[model samples]
Target: MSGEFNLIEKYFVDQQAQRSDVVLAAGDDCALVSAPVGSLIAISTDTLVAGTHFLASANPRWVAHKALASNISDLAAMGATPAWVSFALTMPEIDEIWLAPFCEGFFALADQYGLQLIGGDTTKGPLSLTLTVQGLVPQGEALLRSGAQVGDGIYVTGLLGDSQAGLDVILDKSNATKPFASELEKRHYLSTPRTQVGEALRGIASAAIDISDGVISDLGHILKRSGVGAQVEVEQLPLSQPLLEFVGSSPQAQQYALTSGEEYELCFTVPDSREDAMWQALQDIDCQITRIGTINDDDKLRLTLDGQDLAWQLSGYDHFKTN
Candidate 1:
């Protein structure tokens, strides 16, 4: 069995992404990063356990991708520019085949965002992955869940419920056929962070959050923090065609869109005054933005379908209540 130091040198050090802000990377007691002037550092951490987050039989490559993507998604929600990441891998044993592809996937996404792998650790334990990522945002401009206000328009970036459908396919619960099944699984494993769109929303969005838990659950955070309520139009949910086909009913698909977790899309609110400007700013970003609801002063979330009141009994992922 290869030792921890040996594995770090072979798989974690000297990654492809290089950042000028990273003064010292890997092989040190603590990594050093230079904070940009007039900028605030935003940091987030996520942990993926073998059975809790992904199947043990999952591909190492996608596992690495999901681990890194989840953490970066938090940074994106804060309207931050990704700059550095530190990873920690705990596994019962190391397989060279798994190590090679895992490193490949981790560095690939890091390089795409110009993230430097500053430091991390490899240890003997149950199979799990943890990552801490840091990003920079202009002082006083970081997006937060408490910034929302009554009468703001609620919007979501990209389609929802696809990741949950993908999970169903992975676990053999989906009846979806080929092409569609593959597409669903891809969306599950390879979630986009929406960093660019989040940055674009910095000044425009009144409040924002990344949808890791279902949209209802994550958006609830924004509402609770801002002391506001929301009226969501069920018919307006951004459900993808593949998800609709997989579930075989518009209503069922919307249910999944509302309650399924791990979507990683952004749910944001924009003041009525900034609505037009928000659209104009996000035009160049390669993401689909949909208006799905409105913030209100009632301090409760209300669901409606086709102008009729809709009752929602379902909830999103809760670490304690789920599984």
Candidate 2:
């Protein structure tokens, strides 16, 4: 075994070797698990590559937090409670300082959500991290994109476009030492996956998805899967005060709000009749839910800006596009 693999096996894998619920764990070709009867399994995987998902010189702690949080967002989209996660990290070299802070941030967030790090793999390669998260829900009760119907009210949690704003600052480099830089940087680094809000939406939302690929694009998934369309008011898009100040109400800013990725908020559809109740439920959980638009029978996605309907020149973030 290599030195890094030996380190992981000794410090991490061996420590988790005795968990009773871990049917199969480390030191194996593949991990296995036995799910309880009547419970459904939810699994999600996400990969973060240096210089793509994050900068090559990005803080290791935040990189680790984001790697785990992104997968947790998938669990939230299905209204599942996170149970366990396994990480696969590829790095050119093992830096103890980087690994320590990275693990600290990773474990802190995992512990906050009651998730256990069961097992993982480490290897020598370019810096990349992948996390596979498993969650559980009652059988047949998982929320799906196919549940949306016409006349369903569209709701989103928190504000949009802050992460994009943060990304701009990071890329510019000139803004790094500015006063608002810290706040903008936090938006990109410390994404809060809506796990609690998603759990609270179990019986309330008709359909749900996380806003990882920007609102218009992510909502397109629900529309396509549900075989419905929507009419959204651009003004109703919740923008953070910082984002407002940063972009200054420009048409360009509006486009970024619609297309920026990595916001990690929840966009869901609920019946109009359940609107009040859903709002109350969200409030009780201390989550902010904004009613942004409504699903429509017409098979067209429409956006209204200042009482005038306009065609979107673009949808949302596309991985292959230069954007």
Candidate 3:
């Protein structure tokens, strides 16, 4: 360990640093946590680099917000209520002008979810941010990808591919300011983690996952983990009004919508018998839940469009792909 400001010492290492359920924290040697007797812990981490995750020139405040929201989405998948988070920021230099607004955006969402920032580290390096978030659920009640079963109905929250549509606009900059383009851009920047929706889904969803690496790929995680297959109806895949207007009904746009990354909507599976109640519950909260597909016992993932089977051109976004 280098002697330069120890992260544990400056930020984590002391009883005075305790924020919530962190019974013991950094400084000594180990961190201790306490959970309510009937509660389970849900933890997740996400990292965003300047050039990799967002444009190098992206606003610092939005960057901070996305970094936290992405990790919070994981907790949502587990149907957990967020509790705390620790941030690790590595930047080339310290700029108060940037950090101030960044912290404001970060804390604003954290406060909204009642999450406490317990500890974190700041270092000199390229612009990168990582957040480790924790949440709580009733013991043995956390949702899991492995819980999905055949014959389950597939559902997705909100729309898909709006973020990808916004990204395309930013990259090409071809179109003049259009209403759809503006909405897509805003959705790409200000995605809300479905914490309330997730919590409401507890005991209802058989399996769940957040769409981070596009719908096709993220859904594959659920199918693979649950040892089940799924057949999605391309026509039923929910596309935001902005996305439909921006991309139109072109084949290429449909491919991108199916494979583009950074869509943070929740995809879940529920039994048909429970569909009515589930939809009612989510609708009560004003969340638009769309049925896009159904689970299958066959070991093949398939897609259908307008009552006809169609081969998907792409399996979904992969970070390693040259495309």
TM-score, every prediction: 0.95, 0.91, 0.88
TM-score of 1: 0.95
Task: Tell me the tens digit of each residue's lDDT in model 2 across 199-268.
Answer: 8888889999998898998999999999999998888888777777776665656677788788888899
Instruction: Kindly list the per-residue Cα lDDT of model 1 for residues 129-179, writing each as its tens digit.
Output: 888999999998899999999999999989999998888787774345634
Better of 2 and 3 by TM-score: 2
Quality of model 3 by C-alpha lDDT: 0.78
The number of the candidate with the highest TM-score is 1
Pick by lDDT: 2 or 3, better one? 2
Tens-place lDDT per residue, model 3, 205-264, is 999999889988888989999999999888887776667677776565667667867777
Candidate 1 ranges beyond 4 A from true positions: 1-5, 173-179, 318-323
Please give the TM-score that candidate 2 achieves against the real structure.
Answer: 0.91
Worst 10 residues of 3 by lDDT: 8-17
- The clash number for model 2 is 0
Angstrom error at residue 160, model 3 = 0.6
User: Which segments of model 3 are wrong by more than 4 Å?
Assistant: 1-33, 175-179, 250-253, 318-323
- Measured by C-alpha RMSD in angstroms, how accurate is candidate 2? 2.7
- Ten-residue segment with the worst summed lDDT in candidate 2? 10-19
Best by lDDT: 1
